[model samples]
Target: MPSRAPDDIERAHLRDPNDRRFTIARRLPPEPLRAWLRRFWIPVWDVPDGESAAQRVLQYPVCLSITTPGYSRFVGPNPGLSTTVLEGRSWGFGTMFAPAAGAVLSPGTLRDLAGTHCDLEQIPALAGLTEPVRVLMAEDPSAEETHAACCALVEERLERLGVPGEEDLLINAIVEEVEGDSSLLTVGQLGERFGLGERSLQRLVSRRLGLTPAWLIRRRRLHEAAGALRGTEELAELAARLGYADQSHFTHDFRTSTGSTPGEFARRWRDES
Candidate 1:
């Protein structure tokens, strides 16, 4: 089984650490499903009347989530930060999908869903599981029970669809390699390492993930940089570690993706903390 520790780089993206409005728990699924499922997450929140807390996250590659008294949806890769306001009392359970798992879960190509959220009922393969999922989550079961129920639902879906193909595994492997190595700064470099021609690599990723190899590499660097901003003031060193040419280049990309300079973001987080 994969390690259960949360991605430390992702944890740094939280909008507020001082706000005591909610709690989140994450667990690994059973061994059979790990190839397709990243982790199961449950977030429970209660806000005082007339007061609301906003939770912000730099979403993982992809996700399928069900909110209580709410809706069930599959969210594609979001290029920017995603934020939701919490009011009253509410909870949600979500399945974080592996990068290429969408190929098996969606009837259409993943490109169609990029930067968008689709209702689970709209997808043929996942539609049947929607209502049963709602009933199981509505009962407010314990974490262990919730994990078991979700695992069963996913297992059934995989069984019906059959196992993922080699193309799916190839796409996933590419994503894993980029995420694991910061030195891979460009799609050309990534292709060389994987022994694929640049255009072939691009075509493969675009077909399966609806995203380019460059986008995946840049997003991973930005996510790690966002996490480091809170702890380090040496922007140049941070940029070097993230494989950027220099601080200026890193600043440009960070502002483009996050809408704020690293220094400004760090200052705001510090003030709030």
Candidate 2:
């Protein structure tokens, strides 16, 4: 019989990351993040509740996103990094797509990319996805190498769409915002800073980044709150800093977006910590 697959590796659309929730001690190393998934998409089963699934994908600065077959044939705003779990039945391999400059739009009112398995040239309205894309994914080359290559090719195409001479600035600004306050900064605020009107900024952000500025900021804040939950920061205090008017409000939003309340998240995190 073929040697048992390594524990670190698993077959497609099978394994679940939901049974157990895990927290990274630090930022997930980019090397590993960029490397192929040794197993199927791990679900973040503990986001807003008892368990969500080990699968979580997000786009940060310019709407960095992680996708699976689950997002296929779907549209509409995803809440909380838009945490979505996808199975190989629709798509395979957990892939991460980062925006280098512009925005990425979900194929709203369009068919899922998995349906056609189309090559780059055949992909419809891809220009509407985003600009300056950097996609990374790994799969058994012998079995699904073609899809893997397709992802890479798509990344190259998107990368070419980065905003002219503004990729670096946009990335830095978003990162800074995420790293800074958790205040209730509105879309208009984000747009004004970019020297664009609210609607214009929204269009730019949606077109190039694939998400609204609000989603990006909210997700980052939630991630930070999750990180801070186990630290010295007071629970009530942290929630406020993240722009939650009160603990209940923060708890509700966190659970809605992440699938777990702040107290529960911290408790689980403490167990893990």
Candidate 3:
């Protein structure tokens, strides 16, 4: 396997150039499935004996379905950073699902499973896929055909769900709006833009996404902030662009979530880059 750049660098994750024990490949889903699934990522790792490496992700505000040699799970939207450790020579096949698709695939409401995961075998639609996906990944974790076969299995399962319902489409659109528009900084603004009342919007988001509308805005800003910090933009200007009242407020929020001040994070990013 060869080292490839991340599919979306703005999305936060921890990586070390010195540790070249892993290679990841990400491919977009088929066009018809794009509305429900974001992409498929396959990561193959070969850590040396007696050593371990950690992979951290500031996950997007959506759900994930990940299959590894040991386990297969349906992971809910994580409200904060997530970390996974890797050891030995192994691989993982994971999919980032759209906001609307979580409820459809999860055994219970999204609200019940936030920040946690359940066995994939529990989900009727996804049960049969675990073993086959695992076998294909094990055979050739770095092969293009392996990736396509995994995707094909998922696509076949999802096609049985038929067209997404009206609410599913609405939530997908709502997430798209929140992610694309930097000007939407508050729940009120999001409600107005979507013609939904605060409580109604809150209910919809919490039920389908297991998160508050406010979290959606903050996550988007932080993701953009992390990406922007890699550049040379002034802190004050960056804060203003992301709808923060001031740089201090922005720094406070970033520090609270990431345990490091924006300046410190930026410096580390620069040093690492």
Candidate 4:
């Protein structure tokens, strides 16, 4: 029998019966794009249809993804922050004051982003930050966890630098709200809580987060809803707790974002715990 090649949109690899860590074969050409940013991107990996040996990795960097359902490219950046896009079933988001130019970045765009080993490992007096210099940055398993941890660490670093506490406070606030309950966090609320005008906070957060406050709210709530459905609650209650008006709303949003319903997701596989 002739062996079939991998299809576009599916990354395939030879799988070992035992030892399931991660396996990536290859991917197809990304679908062409109309616009760069301003929406979520759907990159069908140009790999084969094979079991993802990787235990659905939950960790990666934390950079707000801004692309459309159409493509994974980006336009000009939100000021004061940068992102290092990576490849995986998941993505990342975080906030960092854009470092000065001439600094190294992760392997996102390297015509080349990394110059030398010194730049790669320097850690820039900002300790928690992983320089965008890793050849295998995207492949790291604990990527998101590490990035979120870095954000927390950078909070302390900025404090030591005598940066005004508000910006860092605001970052922590958004992170907490996103990590917890985004249903209640609003841009207007952030402005009122921090005494900044709405526009000002919007600009600040957009610059730092690379996303609007509403995006953060939606991302966090959706994330929580997914967690609740898989780990904690039934679909009906999960939808309500995550602030969806009802289960149908939850199903719609979930299918739109993840291409699956709560019941489908829950029943598709056994709990890994």
User: Best by lDDT, which number?
Assistant: 3
* Alpha-carbon local distance difference test for all models: 0.74, 0.43, 0.85, 0.39
Worst 10 residues of 3 by lDDT: 1-10
lDDT of 1: 0.74
Model 2 residue 39 lDDT score = 18
Query: Model 3, 223: alpha-carbon shift in Å?
Result: 0.5
Per-residue lDDT for 137 in model 2? 25
- Mark the 10 consecutive residues where model 4 has the least summed lDDT: 30-39
Candidate 1 lDDT, tens digit per residue, 129-165?
A: 7677667766774455765676578566755655667
**Per-residue lDDT of candidate 4, residues 1-273 (tens digit):** 111124321111111224333333221111221011111112222223453323221211132222212222212222211223333343322222221111122223321222111222233443324433122235442343433333344344434443334454455555455555555756687567657787886676555444456665665565565455545567887787777888898899867665557777665433443
Give the C-alpha miss distance for residue 17 in model 2, angstroms.
9.7
Task: Return whichever of 3 and 4 wins on TM-score.
Answer: 3
Off by over 4 Å in 4: 1-19, 23-61, 64-166, 182-185, 269-273
Ranking by lDDT: 3, 1, 2, 4
What is the TM-score of each predicted model, taking all chains together? 0.87, 0.51, 0.93, 0.46
- Please give the RMSD to the true structure for each candidate, in Å: 2.6, 9.8, 2.7, 14.5
Model 1 misplacement above 4 A: 1-9, 141-143, 268-273
CA error at residue 171 for candidate 3, angstroms: 0.2
Q: Comparing candidate 1 with candidate 4, which one achieves the higher TM-score? A: 1
Arranged by TM-score, best first: 3, 1, 2, 4
